[model samples]
Target: MTPKIVIFDWDGTLIDSVDHIADSLHLAATELGFPALERDAYKDIIGLGIIEALQTLYPGLAMDEIQAIREGYGRYFFSKQTTPQNVFAGISELLAELAGANAQLAVATGKSRRGLARALESSGLGAHFAVTRCADETRSKPDPAMLMEIVEHFGIEPGEAVMIGDTIYDMDMAQRIGMPAIGVEWGVHPRARLEEFAPAAVASDMAALRQALYLA
Candidate 1:
């Protein structure tokens, strides 16, 4: 069946911003007098929002400290690194193919609404997505609320849309809503880690992701 709409995960799926994220997290942690997260540890927190990520990283910290760290991370991430985020190779081509196929597009991300908007505008992908649901619009990843919001906003059913992302949160949220998910391997999370969510299919690269989306 043809997909009526396509929902994308912003950060690691379409944009290669893991390095920026790690940098911000590291800077924030250091500023807060906490240990910087190791690379592997950062990978494990890819899909969650900043608040959740901070909680996971410094669970022993007091609530106020956690809030402060989250605030610091947000400020640095948006002001310092967002503009430098580059789109993954072939992602633009794939998105073009999907758009040419008349598939409505949207974004569901753990990023804040303002941050996602800035990233898209800076990256020249703002016009491509008809709707964008960020952390401020709904609960964080794995909640299914954002995905559900996207579906409703676009007037499409779960089965009529596919959620494409690079993390388990994306896959599991799609599963919860009975939507097919196309998992990409080159993002923050590795293939082995993504497989735990039982995605409908896994794509090793943008070319393969196009095929999974029935655009190739």
Candidate 2:
């Protein structure tokens, strides 16, 4: 890969926390007396920011209800998750290898700054990334603004950066800037769905993802 910077999505790309997220959404809905949803309803919005995810999850809900679900979900998720999220296989190695290669690594995630901070602190890999952009700070995924900001921060051209993620949102954002993007299969979105956004490739596993990043 000729790209000097590699941008990664957090939740499903680096860690397997969709199940917990879905569970938290479900519990929050139940506690708030909201209508029950089908299995994995929350999972469908895994790559979106919390506000966007909540809106997508409950489209008809009033703003007040949306806020309620958001707060409830946050409370439930943090309370139940005492341990650090389970990092995906080969993810740690991938980050270390990327850094070792002098490729700048950064996160452009839908997670809040606080949430990302918590994960980074617990993972003990915060220093691995040179920069990070959160949904709370910028427009959500599928929007190219954050990608633009990152490249600007590094003073690199869009062609010199690649976005690695598991969702169409990530692919779309990078694609909008005419940047190369790689998708991972072991995440919330299916490979077929991620391909719809025209990612360069969608790896079925971490080894393939490493190869896609040219880090292996």
Candidate 3:
């Protein structure tokens, strides 16, 4: 059965911004004279909040260092053009179809509130979601705090909602709260990585994703 509430992850799942994000992180580290890891290493942290991602990538950072990297990353990321064109093909249609079906859509992302605001505006997808939860406003992914908040806001049971994302963190958070999860492949993490979390389904394309949501 289709869920009444559908929660989505932002960066990799809705938009094709993984390369842009990974590149910006590399640029930030290079600008700070910090050692750069493989591009995949940057991509691996896509679902995590900026501070948490930075801490995982470069451990033992002083508060000042974390702030500096955060600022630098923000500078690099915002410098690029973020437009509706970044949204994945078929996403707008999918959101429309879900909304038409009376599904309550929401975003549970690792993006800062400010960042998500800009993305929503640029992507022209903001009004499609009934609500949004940002990492800066609550505990980050894999903690279940943000997801729980969204579920609570909608006054729905965990089983009545479904999470669709591109990372293990998304699956882990939903699992912790007993919410069903669906993984998308064309994102930061591979199918194998998402499979380890035992998602309800792993979609390779938008059509498959729609089918997984019982829309097709």
Point to the candidate with the largest lDDT.
3
Output the better candidate (1/2) by TM-score.
Answer: 2
Candidate maximizing TM-score = 3
- For candidate 1, write residues 1-216 as lDDT tens digits: 448999999888888887778787888789877876677787667778767777787787777887787788787788754443388877777778778889888999988787887888888888889988887668888899998888888777898899999888899899998999988988877788778888878999877877787766
Error of 3 at 85 (Å): 0.9
> Which candidate would rank higher by lDDT, 1 or 2?
2
In model 1, what is the error at residue 166, expressed in angstroms? Answer: 0.5
Error of 3 at 56 (Å): 0.5
Any runs in candidate 3 off by more than 4 Å, and if so which? none
TM-score of 1: 0.93
For every model in order, what is the number of clashing pairs? 0, 0, 0
Rate residue 209 of model 3 by lDDT: 98
How large an RMSD does model 2 have?
1.5
C-alpha TM-scores of all predictions: 0.93, 0.94, 0.98
Per-residue lDDT of 1-216 in model 3, one digit per residue for the tens?
568999999999999999999999999888898998999999999989999999999999988998998999999999986788999999999999999899999999999999999999988999999899999999888889998898899887898899999999999999998999999999988999999988999999999999999998
Against the true structure, candidate 3 has what lDDT? 0.93
Q: Give the poorly placed runs of model 1, Cα more than 4 Å off.
A: 79-85
